[model samples]
Target: MQQQRWWRGATIYQIYPRSFLDVSGDGVGDLPGIEAKLDYVASLGVDAIWISPFFLSPMADFGYDIADYCAVDPLFGTLADFDRLLARAHSLGLKVMIDQVLSHSSSEHAWFKESRSSRDNPKADWYVWADAKPDGSPPNNWLSIFGGGAWQWEPRRGQYYLHNFLVQQPDLNFHNPAVQQATLDNVKFWLDRGVDGLRLDAINFCFHDRQLRDNPAKPPEKRTGRGFSPDNPYAFQYHHHNNTQPENHAFLERLRALMDQYPDVGALGEISAEDLLGTMTDYTRPGRLHMGYSFELLTEDGSPGFIRRTVEELQAHMTDGWPCWSVSNHDVPRVVSRWGQGSTHPHLASQYNALACSLRGSICLYQGEELGLPEADVPFEAIQDPYGIAFWPTFKGRDGCRTPMPWQPGNGAGFSAATPWLPVPDAHRALSVATQEADADSTLHRFRRFLAWRKRQPALTAGELRFLDAPEPLLVFERTHAKQRMLVAFNLSDQPQSVALPDLDSWHADTGHGLLSGHAEGQRLQLPARGVYYAVAPAA
Candidate 1:
């Protein structure tokens, strides 16, 4: 296969290190473990793998809080281990994209340590610091994404520092030219090391309102919870001044310039904002990020109307910019459980899985998505995510989705010799890689088939999306290129239904043949409950 510059049309897999595999008996995942599994990952037919942060950290926010921008964490293995993993993945024709945390740094970082040492220190201005008001309150009324006021008072400097996340993860003042340059340099350091691309974590939060103005309270209806927490007060405000600032565009362009220096190195931004679709559009225009994705499909809704509406909105809003869509990742519950209506019906699972690829953008498949793995139920004691711990029961935390990948049915699910970090769900153990690998009709097998089939269809991969009008519970659309046109229809219902072709002379049903399981009808197609169909329209 030849390489392409635009990875926006690519399928990338996300790997959560601690829960992926524990190569060493330390009961934690390491680089060597990921390297060893490259073959398994490559077999999935995805274009690349976006490995979660493996940098030096106290694991406060897992790898999100960076202690060192350049060094691999000792727990994840030395830098040499990462090099080995990178080399192996490249050799297997798989691109490696690493997560880059730019918005903040751990308080333990040398810069923060030095800056907080004293107000007159050389690095004192490296981070955002403000003096308390006469009343001894925070400088302004900004709140952290994890809850409470964003400002943390530092007794040493007699000033408060801003933290958009955990108190330990202090927000870096990107408004400072030095800080921006330093962060860009860190990105170039990795680009020079042969890494294929970067997945910018919290890109919108890189810049904040310079004025530190108070954020407005969100309307009662608009206060539907975000990733911070369900009951966390962070959800009450509209987050106007804290994040999604206008200055992020300037920083993104600078980062883009650095990435463009390398021929094939790409950048994908993770936009977590109230107006995600708008943010994605702005971030992915010509000179900004190569691609971007939002949390539109990550929620618990999977109705055909919701899916169609999301794609329609993106198509209308995202003009020249490309889109990368993912329904589940380490942050959210698996789609199988999220949208499965609490049933393990194979048809429903297959329908949802197909919908992931049918959308008009690059697709992202999390580690265990192939097995139709439902979200694991981790007891409160087993929960390790602080974000989840703070809002237990109401939001059970992300640990359920971060469980180790089930490679086999043997001890530790063949992920490690000792006990794994998170317990593997019993339901997932039976649907292990070994079991699915042997079943030709399994979801894993369908993914490989779909990718292989989709590769040959330029219309499906690189063409434009045109939504077709249809009755409720039916998603109808067409993906078209120069001379090829593919009509994709999916039945999101449990009961059978039929869709009549509006205007067609002849059509060939390609379902159950190409691109996973779907069929075609001459003019009218009948769909089984939760069934999907992909057909090719005859030449006009």
Candidate 2:
């Protein structure tokens, strides 16, 4: 497995601890709970698990805001509990990648507290502190991703500290070499502890423009990039000076050099910028991140052309760096709801999973993805996300996608002994693990079968991809590795479709994935609604 470079073309499943499983009867998921479900996770045939932030936090942004980098929060358990979780996951042959928020830390963090205490405190310059303009305004016009201006007034420091997201989460001064080294040291701590890898959160935001230049305004017609909502105001301008600075590459190299010391350890970064795919390319170059993914596929556009363009564009520039693609995560609405015309189509989810896994890069499958769970309907009364509360009706934020994972059909959906933090939707309960396990033809079983079957195909697992010309609702691609070449096709629509391959000497259809299989009749392949077809040339 060491020679295999396990992360390449790997399937990494993401688990949001707050909603995954609650073993402590506190209505929140914890490390021990993740450990308790290690076997279940392994059963899905994923190569690794990417656990969202479980570090010590005040829960302002629900674990994304870090108060202490080295300690685990009591809400999720202690450092010893993390050790146990790591041990059990490794014992099950699954790598564990934990989230590392390097761009910002909670205001409650001792470093930020000291930095904001006085102008010349020991750690005063540890954070991004800027004096107000002569007119007593923010140094520049920058908007927080959550809402409002990015600057938060610090009365003690007599300046405004930058917060790209929440006011409580202040950005660090990475331009200062001390801050850079300290952050890398924190990363070294986890690698030293034997975690398989790190999921660098907002890694590109580590460095801001040193000049503090004003961000150029983006025209209204050209105002769509990261999130779907226009009400958030973050999408109003081109985020040039705020993040994805040129100096950040050096820091990434430093981080990479640190990770290279650990055997087979890697970093998967989350990139969100004006040029999403282009920045993803830039961040994942040879000496930078091992792999990087963006919010491109997480959008509402689920058309065949859009998906093709995204992968094709990245593949065009993906020379030495690697790519990790995710169709669903805790940050956005569930793909089944977002992609399948505002509803959950079971067949569509199955086809989409196979399609995403079939792509050339590594794959990240969110927790409820296996069961084809759609976005849960979280009402305003139940909303906890601050971002959601800011822009309620127009944009519900990410609460729908962060509900508890249902393990059983009843009794708190087997998630907790008490009322869960987020209510487990009745629909999710019906598609719980226990319920799906009993059904022979469930989406969960299909998912397991596809992943298990995929591991045996080198062409599907680690191969070069080329998209073939096909009509709408049909995505056709070829994956070649060593001597094996595979032709993978998917019907993205609910209606059956057919595609003509036309130029093949001998292509044999493959099976065992348990989806709606397609047939290859003399270069003419017929696909059922949401069907998947796999074929290989004998000489290939």
Candidate 2 stretches greater than 4 Å from native: 1-4, 342-345
Which 10 consecutive positions of candidate 1 have the poorest summed lDDT?
511-520
What are the lDDT scores of the predictions, listed in order? 0.83, 0.89
Task: State the lDDT of candidate 2 residue by residue for 1-540, as single tens digits.
Answer: 235267988999999999988989999999999999999999999999999999999999999999999999999999999999999999999999999999999999999989988988889889998999999999999999988999989899789999999999999999889999899889889998999889999998998898999999989898776565677678888999999999998889899888888888879999988877678878888778889875678888988899899888888877677889889999988889888885345677888889889988889999999999989999999999998889888889889999999999996999999889988899899989999999988999999999999998888788888999999989888999986888888888888898788674367778877788988767688888888888887435
Residue-level error in angstroms, candidate 1, position 373: 0.6
Q: Estimate each model's TM-score.
A: 0.96, 0.98
lDDT (Cα, tens digit) per residue for candidate 1, span 486-540 = 8888877767778787753355567543332444455677777777777676435
Q: CA shift at 32, candidate 2, in angstroms?
A: 0.7
Residue 63, model 2: Cα distance from true site in angstroms = 0.5
User: Where does candidate 1 stray beyond 4 Å?
Assistant: 1-6, 225-228, 512-522, 538-540
Model 1 whole-model lDDT (C-alpha atoms): 0.83
